[model samples]
Target: MAEPDWDRMMQAAQAGDADSYRRLLGEVGAWLRRYYHRRLPPAMVDDAVQDTLLAVHEKRHTYDPARPFGAWLGAIARYKWIDRLRAMKSHPSVELDENLPVPGHEEAVSSAVSLERLLAELKPAQADVIRLVKLQGFSIMEASHRTGQTMSLVKVNIHRGLARLSAMIRSRNDAG
Candidate 1:
């Protein structure tokens, strides 16, 4: 039998020919193993190689057939390696609020309006600092940089603003 043409095998595989896919995989599997081993742990190399091949199979439609098949395959393998590395480095045990209940939309809206009214009662500087550091999700350092204010001043303004707003909110709730 004539030696198998690799380019022909790749082309056939791209066209969804099962035999050509198997042949190509068998031929390239060793190279893929070496490729992955250079980047991943020995224990992870086989799984990474398998995942890369599977991703290549799944995303074959996105491949430009005009491009060199090896280049496209290499790109897929690189991305899969990155994904594996990210997964390995990630801490799965996140510190989440298990006891926190989901707030309803109405409750969220009312709380937002109350906060807005409270913030509006403060002086512009106090309101701006509080909104930047608290309401708008900015860190204290970020709020300081954005407002061109000192960190100590920003902290003081936010503390006093929040205290005043809290007292006002409590008084309003009592009167109602």
Candidate 2:
């Protein structure tokens, strides 16, 4: 049998081929394990591998067929690996035992939840794009990585979602 093609499998997976997606993820999991094995302890390697696979599963839609699939996978793997390293840190600059009350913290949290609800009113794709790009300050590529949206799709969703939100706010203000 011929060797499996990564890009072709990814494209198929994007087109809703469950078998292809499963095969691709299985291969990716193996690849991630190998990539992280040397960098992480034996206990941590599995977590890193799982993390990268989950990231890939989430962002598979963003894979541009024109780009090399390995590179895309590598980017996700690197990001996950770095996250693991950060999580493994034991040294802390400040202890968390100090529970100091900050002014408006409750208000800020409430407002943040309200904003999230407003975002949820958009289409799923639009809401995700807006939350990642506008609220989370993620770059287009980073948003693409997280949400698996093409660059154009991400931009268009943000534009349309923002416009809709503006109209909604205007209506609310006019009514008030």
Candidate 3:
């Protein structure tokens, strides 16, 4: 049998032909997995492939029938791969604090004041590095690159700043 045309397959799939969709998915899945495998770890390839397929399925209606199906599929796969990389690098974890009660109005105001004081103790550069790397979730390399500072400088500033903050917090707690 002759090789199936991708545009035709996509059109047929879009028209609700189950077999065409299945064939398109099977053909694209392997290519997508290989694409993701090159950009990500082996363990993430399958997940990237699945996510790409689901995205393609969900967004199929938006696909311009005039465009090549592989290109559209590839674009979706690339987006999903990048998203997975970002997510894996900084995966959000939910911490359930059952023991910690929500702060009231007065507590919130006091906590804000305390944080301001704590941050104010550090020099501007140190404070900026701490805020970028610790508070803003940038990696040291990212902080350095974003701030135009050397990685070593960023690391030193963060370390010293954190030590100073710890000492200040401890002293305040002890005094209180």
Candidate 4:
């Protein structure tokens, strides 16, 4: 079958055409289902589609008639897909194998201790910025606020600190 003119349907829907709006929603739902099913797990596909549909409904007023409908729909669907991924990451539903060995935290702790020891070799300002912006994943501006330093200073400290750390590693390697 030929594809319907989604832009025209959406324009009609915007103009208070109830039947056209219903048809448009039905067609969009089908398209969204196909779109999500290919990317998400089977169990999550339906929820993703429904979430996209609701977003489309809520943001229908923002859709420009001059723009292609598919582009707008795709953008919303992509955002919803990313949201689903983030949610999954934050609360994974994977079943752990009982027979699988769980690694100890000793390696992680040792690495952290080694990193702190290396950071200590740098100036206090440089070490603070590197810890805040790199290790703790804060933005430069946030690090600046936390350290009472300007944004530019935070960036400079990070750059210098990393260079120093790299040189320290190289020197140790050459000596050993």
Candidate 5:
């Protein structure tokens, strides 16, 4: 029947009163859940509420005692809700792992071992260049830095290494 004393609760909370702080956060969280439910999907309401509450907890020190607590809380909640909406729009959820890649595992190890053996067939410099750039995902600049080679030399090694690897694979395929 009475309006909740938000300012008093918030002031008490700011003064280090644990019970009031807990009560304020609980009430705010409940209110935010209801507010979010009207605007967001059911699954998203709880997440928004939790995020808003966490922001409030983290930014509590910024609260000015003279200001209306509801306004401050509303500002935080509004931003959080908007952020959630933006995230939802930007990253629409997909039912991932419901269906696995399920690739054939029969030759997985043999393929890896075979690839390693193929690399080993090249000169060590060529093998190292290919492994650094192609296999290990290092940038050309990084590979050059790691191997103490110049940028031009790194490029040359990568080109030569790839050509050699292609010939090796082709020879293997032709023989097999």
Candidate 6:
């Protein structure tokens, strides 16, 4: 199948074409689903998709016709993902069945795969620092010593690496 001209469709939607607008939303929603499917927890995926769509709808007028539609949509989508993360952190879910054993092997592997994919997008230095500090539970000082980087550099790399990973997640067209 041929790819839709998202830029034109969005422009037409902005100009009050109801049919084009509907088509645009449909396509965008599908794209968002692919974008979030692996990134979010399974239970959170539907809510995240709906939240991102709502954000896109509310911010539709802010989209620039001269810019790439994917980039614009990605920016909004990334913000929505961050918002969801923040909300989840602030309101951690309660365990419904404390007596039930949590089966973590599959979840751990899935998370690791996703982490590696995201890490592959970063610079070697950044990726190394993140892996040592974030994934391996190394202190900044320990990561610095192991990586032969200054403590401050280790901290900086971790921060930049995570930020880049988050920003690039929405922009990548790997959903296919």
Candidate number achieving the greatest lDDT relative to the actual structure = 6
lDDT per residue as tens, model 5, 1-176: 11258788888988899999898888887777656554443445567888888899889988898877776776676566557534532332312222122442323334345557767888787778666765455777898899998878877776676566555543442211
Q: Model 2 over residues 1-176: C-alpha lDDT tens digits?
A: 11249889999999999999899888877766556544443445566787778788888888998977877787677666556544533211112212223543444445456557667888999889776765555677888888989988888887787666655543452210
Backbone clashes for every candidate come to 0, 1, 0, 0, 0, 0
lDDT of model 6 at residue 82? 63
Candidate 6, 1-176: lDDT as tens digits: 11358889989989999899898889888877666655654455568889988888788899998878877887777677766544533332312223223554454456457768878889999989877765555677888889899998987777677677766764565423
Estimate the TM-score of every prediction: 0.47, 0.49, 0.50, 0.52, 0.50, 0.57
Q: List the residue pairs that clash in candidate 4.
A: none
Model 3, 18-93: lDDT tens per residue?
Answer: 9988988887777665565444434355677888888889999988988666666656665665465345324321
- The model with the greatest TM-score is 6
Order by lDDT, highest first: 6, 4, 2, 5, 3, 1
lDDT of 4 by residue, 1-176 (tens): 11458899999988889898899899989877666544444446668888888998899998899988877787777667657644543332323224223442343344356567767899999989876766555777888899999998877777777667656654452210
Q: Which stretches of candidate 2 lie over 4 Å from their true place?
A: 1-4, 90-176
CA deviation > 4 Å runs, candidate 6: 1-4, 94-112, 115-176
Candidate 3: where are CA atoms >4 Å away?
1-4, 92-176
Candidate 1 worst ten-residue window by lDDT: 91-100
Would you give me the overall lDDT of model 3? 0.63
